[model samples]
Target: MSFILFLRQLGLSLAEIKAILTSDYSEQTLLLNKKQALQEEIARLQALEQTIDDQLQQVNQQDTLQVDQPIHLRVLQRLPFAQDFDLSVVETIDWQPDWMLRQLYYVINETDYAICMATPAVSDYQIDAGCYVTTTIEAASGAEFDSALAAITTHQTLPLIGIEMRGTFLSPGKHLAVKILGNRKE
Candidate 1:
């Protein structure tokens, strides 16, 4: 044992020291177990959706998010709604890391991705000119925001032109977009 820990536990019995060593990890392990439980619940619900959604003639195919595909995510609420969306690509920005919380995020078939806010009249440099993984966008402000929500809620497909998904590597107003690739089911 390190001198610091040895001295710290000098007064404790050997059994007590062992407990301290292992007990430190118990709380974190329990919390991580909850993640698995949540995942299993999600799988159960998805199975239920698939089994009961037989009204459609065939199983719904996955939507391949193509390069430069512009997806719309609303910033109206703190939560951007996370789900498979009837089994499409992960289009919504649902969760963010600590420092990154409360900011706009994006994802792809993602492959989850991110984007950023842009000016109304965007410069050509900020338009369809970067690598496929990143882009910028002008999120709907004022009345347009409501319209976007309605359209996305009803149609499940909203074509947003010009605006790129905010990227962290880009300039100010750029939002981070992530795309996880590989390990796709056949």
Candidate 2:
């Protein structure tokens, strides 16, 4: 017999039958509540998954754009200077319209040394020698200081460039070389 009919036959009132069906520990009531909670949780997780997928798509698009861009590098100038030259003088450097100053590379053939470069009455700075020292003006101010040293130490290759070298401490017959590298957009 139907449960509701059985309850009616037992003389249970309508309110008592309803109370038993809707009680907290009833099997049907517990299963229905659990099913609703799981549905809600599934919806929340699906939304999170969609957000992550959107972010991944944006990253992939940026990567594709970067790969399509072309990078063109060229040697802007090659400057040679004496190992023991004074570095407090200023000079101007020439460049082509297509060339943009990007990086400076200092090649030391002699023993390691320390170098300094500064703008006249503006700033003073120092740099230590390595197999090669690289600097980029595109970076922060501190980074530009090192790049300026690499550019200026090689016979004032850039305008208003002044440099001083110390700790040459090289064995006899050692020398130094400096090269300036630049880039342009193709």
Candidate 3:
């Protein structure tokens, strides 16, 4: 076949072939650049996500706390008033080394109190108030303080149920029954 005829038979119109090759190369270059950009973006996003996950893990580890058991404590004070408080159980952890302390505290009326009740009170009917394990727990402010105060205010204040006033100078009432605090096991 003549060279010109052979070219025609091969389906090559010079200008058309050149145009197709140029466009194909251009598309390929564009696709490669897009792939690189996408890879960079994906890497950046992954790094950001990893950083966020690490922060979350740190926070969870720092604040992770639980209550091991319930603690019941009683306090006798000179304050002449009937009051009962219930506080949220924050940290139920072993005290320092061996003993376990179940912390219960409340916050209310600007007063905060904490009680580290002993796990399994020594006496079922009576909790030894003077025991080292059953001491008054107090807080500064914030969540801890609020919790402590709440514990003391939630319980009902029983009006003078039974009381004994002494001396011939006993003003008016013969008997006064103040509110007594009681605990319901959780």
Candidate 4:
């Protein structure tokens, strides 16, 4: 005879029969439900892992492009002519191995002066001889100086340390406005 029928014949109430059946099967049902929940959680975590791997691949590809790009920096200011008729512009720049100095622009209010840049060398002497870039300015405009600097092909890549405008100025209140431009791989 069925368990439920046998229990009913023994004078068990309907609520008592239901309670016995539920207690007998409750452990198995609970274990099955827990297993199903765990499987769903594992599947969700696997999908998330796949998504993270795809994003990492994209970031690696972008990093390669970024390394080939060039970063440009410049410094611009007007310096007064000192009593020795030389305006000294000192700029201490720390350059990385990938840096490439591209161009230099200068706009002097006077026309007769020459511009030179010096840097510390590997020799015992602290200050190396300067490199002469330009000697005369036709105009005092920024655009004119930029154009002039662009035409010069002899400006080699050198370490920037100090800059000076040497020679006499035409007027008493004359000053020099200089711009240094460079590029580097990032």
**Highest lDDT model number:** 4
The residue-by-residue lDDT of candidate 1 on 1-186, one tens digit each, is 683365244444666556657666464564466567678777667644633442121123222223343323443122233332221332353333321222233222112223333223432212232233212223334244334444443533322222222233333652322222212123
Better of 1 and 3 by TM-score: 3
**1 or 4: which has the higher lDDT?**
4
* CA-lDDT, candidates in order: 0.35, 0.36, 0.34, 0.38
Worst 10 residues of 2 by lDDT: 161-170
Model 3 TM-score, 2 decimals:
0.21
lDDT at residue 133 of model 2 (Cα atoms): 24
Question: lDDT by residue for model 4 over 44-137, one digit each (tens)?
Answer: 6765564455345333432221122222223333344221222243342333221222222232323222222212233211221232222233
Tell how far residue 77 is off in model 2, in angstroms: 59
Worst 10 residues of 4 by lDDT: 62-71
Please write out the lDDT profile of model 2 over residues 90-176, one tens digit for every residue: 123333221111222233322332222211232222222222222222222434445555654465333221211111112144323
Give each model a TM-score: 0.20, 0.22, 0.21, 0.21
Cα lDDT of candidate 1 equals 0.35
As a whole number from 0 to 100, the lDDT of residue 36 in candidate 1 is 79
Residue 39 alpha-carbon offset, candidate 4, angstroms: 0.4
Tell me the lDDT of model 2 at 50.
Answer: 46
What is candidate 4's CA lDDT for residue 153?
22
